[model samples]
Target: MCNGLLNPAQYREPQALADEHALIFARTWNFVGLLFEQEAGQHRGVKLGATSLIIQCDKQGRPRAFLNVCSHRHAQLCEQGVHRGPIRCPYHSWTYDREGIPAGIPQPQAFPEVIADKSAHRLKEFACETVGQFIFVRLSTDGPSLRDYLGPEYDFLLHASAGMNGLIDEFRQDVHANWKAVIENSLEGYHVPAVHNQTFMKVEGMERGHQAPVDTVQHPLHSSIDHPAAADWLVTFERKIAPKIGSWAWRFPHYTHHLIFPNLTVTSFLGYSFHIQRFEPSAVGITTVHSRTVSVGFTGQSPVGAKMVEQIYAESKSFTERVFAEDAAICRAVQQGLECAERPAVIGNGIEDRVLHFQRAYQRCMNPTSPPPPT
Candidate 1:
């Protein structure tokens, strides 16, 4: 068993939250959206802590990220959703190019200083990169590249991304809990029997008695669990239907859940479908959970197979949403308890080992000088 490194007060303290925003979120590669989702000349706004960014696809069909604020009047260029046309400021007719340089000025002659030195007036650009279909941005100008930051998980994400065709469902909800509490809840399966009894626990062949042993993989910055499919009705159904539907050639036959540091989770069942979730800290006690589900396409061009895949995707989305709602309720209760509790929580060695792994990573990031917690 591993003892928790983070104290209960850290979950609800204002200073601790601020420190996390600076030392953790700002320095890390934050997931923005999928590159395939953005069309050419389209831009979408996203937030990393207090920093707002615009992840846009250029005319050349390349992904770029820039500060959402315009150079002329510092007004927001785009709203939260997808927008087409140019990245023009609403306050003035100032337009920015793909490089975030001011390309069009309504009254250029009025400001000769900007005309002389346009580089000084350009919108602040940040580091952005893509791994397969995913797009990530870093607020700080300097840090490890996204690939290096992801370490061994880089190959896993690349393979998973290649299998995904497009998103089928997306939603965001505000959980009344600290971000750590929300993430910790997801890192462990200890609560599944209680919180997800009706949804996840009830999945065919996933019952407490019938489930296969989970294989855990731990990295310096990330962790994952792979639950091999049991030899039951569901596994048999997947084996028969997968090849018929022309699923990805490189797909897994098990359920795998991955946690990429600070607050991102990528989970898949049989590698044909994926659920990408991010727990973004909105405030000291509020977390915004952004979730989207994507599925592999039918390449065999069978109408019957396509129909089957659609039905499966629909059922998967419904089940995922139900489990998310249940987890949110439990996370809220955990946060409430943390606010009044005085002792540190203990972690188990079995199913909850990943939770302990996450806590250790959090501590290492927030306090680099601290020694590792004893196992």
Candidate 2:
């Protein structure tokens, strides 16, 4: 960002990363995993910042998230996905129902007081919410509602990801760079022409492609890129599926990229296809990236139409992974460059304003004393 780059210590210092994990991510609604990816009656593990959690659908099929630790001995429960059954703690076999209620104990008579007070012994739950099948959890006790946090941009993101099919293709990479660098790389198109010269440049062309003029707008809790061709490539794809699944018209110059503060990137691929990416930091200069392409409102098509859509989805997924590989390598290099005792701040061209906005948001979160961006 041109305003002020984060100090090298911010990326290299363990203490700084810890503060960010707590202040920036844990306090906000952090996107975990897609709700649709999990089975109706099962438990799946997910991590947000430093907290490991278990997400499950109740008997009535409502989604819930709780700390993975068991109440008995605080042993991690359900390390992986498990089918319909009580969540039994491996340490003491204390069982929990779908609602995370303590259902059974080996010697119920011995601990009558503990058994009577079910609420205290139930799974430790975090504030959980969902937006268009994507699940988010906040470890902090209080904060703005997810809807309030997203502002009007919530509708914009919902439109982009509303009916995404089960995750079809996913590409995860352990990026050896600070999570912020990964996010900065995702926000700006300035590096596309140069960094993605071969992969993305081949399709969109040098001018009208990824390097094309980007009109960026910043909101209170999020920012977006207004790109004309965001939906152009999907015009044909949408038309083909329109007959089977009625017309789904999206506003022109559709959203090319949308960044929800801390860590969530929702980008439009074609008509109703969206790519969701999250940059999660595990430690200083270490991040785990989760990228997935899901089809929105795609279902009940003829065999031929389905096959064609699958082909397009696979091809596009491959292209995206290749582009991401390029970006990840560049981010690592940028991280390595930050090792200098004092480095020149990165100067973003006007086109990279989104990066500056993101940094501003990051600063606001890390240091609550700073003024927040104008809504």
Candidate 3:
């Protein structure tokens, strides 16, 4: 009769899921949208996995993030339109100031002072910090500052920003695969040679040449980040990936930051920058990815550099599309196999460690009060 059975122990403990998220998302900094694009008083909305938030700058131009809903009506304050005026919920017309205070309310006579508790009713806030063009937000009222949360990864972002005054171009790719699968692929570089073999994989593993990072989570099959040679086919390809570019990416819990969260990935070649977010759910493994891209040099750049950069970006986009198509095919197959119990259990190798780390983060955040997952 179509049992609709789910093996929770093997996947997660439902009760502990929220608590686990509190542990992970509460304390860890979440990457929000870029800070530079929005003008002073400008507001933007972002959805991270399941949580949706609206970000706005204070009078000082500093950025802040809060749950977009109004306290009284439980209606979204930030409408679909990005407005510069005070945030107002269309449902009841309740309004909040940029600092997230209850600035105004329609038909106020109905409520007494004790019920308003303006401070408590204001839009719920989370701690946030800005660096360069990026913004980082933490869910809990208490946690380490965004700077400390980044650890050594901060250096990687700084290095990527050295040359470009800011981002020049941006792009996002949508894939029909699980968010976990998409993130794990980003963390490991094992597929570069086999999957991206045509245009990019052809490059030599040298700075002067072309080679993507190798997947390091696993041993035996693991390889070091490609160090390329000049005048080689790889160098030519690297020019396409990004010439005069310093690259760095990190995989954190829930979402991974390229360079740094909020920075909007800036690949030096042609100044191509891409900022992305992915949402997932247990009921369905499919993930929805949203991306924003923009041209960095608001002032513009040299013709020679621009031409070569555009060429590289075009080729890179082609290669990225093909590789992701391959990943989607494989992940869909994996999901189908699991749903059907095609194989009772699957063993993981070193490369699979990234997935293992993801699961652990999920478990730690989920806090499944239930039994352990299937072996």
Q: Write the per-residue lDDT of candidate 1 for residues 176-207, one digit (tens) a residue.
A: 99999998898887888888878988786555
Q: Residue 54 CA error for candidate 1 (Å)? A: 1.0
Best candidate, TM-score-wise? 1
lDDT of 3 by residue, 188-243 (tens): 44555665566445533322223323332222111122222334544454565443
Give the alpha carbon lDDT tens digit for every residue of 82-123 in model 2.
445567788889988888988988988988888889877888
lDDT of 3: 0.51
Model 2 scores a C-alpha lDDT of 0.75
- C-alpha positional error of residue 100 in candidate 3 after TM-score superposition, expressed in Å: 1.3
Clash pairs (backbone) in predicted model 2: none
- lDDT ranking, best first: 1, 2, 3
- lDDT scores of the candidates, listed in order: 0.83, 0.75, 0.51
In model 1, the worst 10-residue window by lDDT is: 208-217
Model 1 spans with C-alpha error above 4 angstroms: 215-217
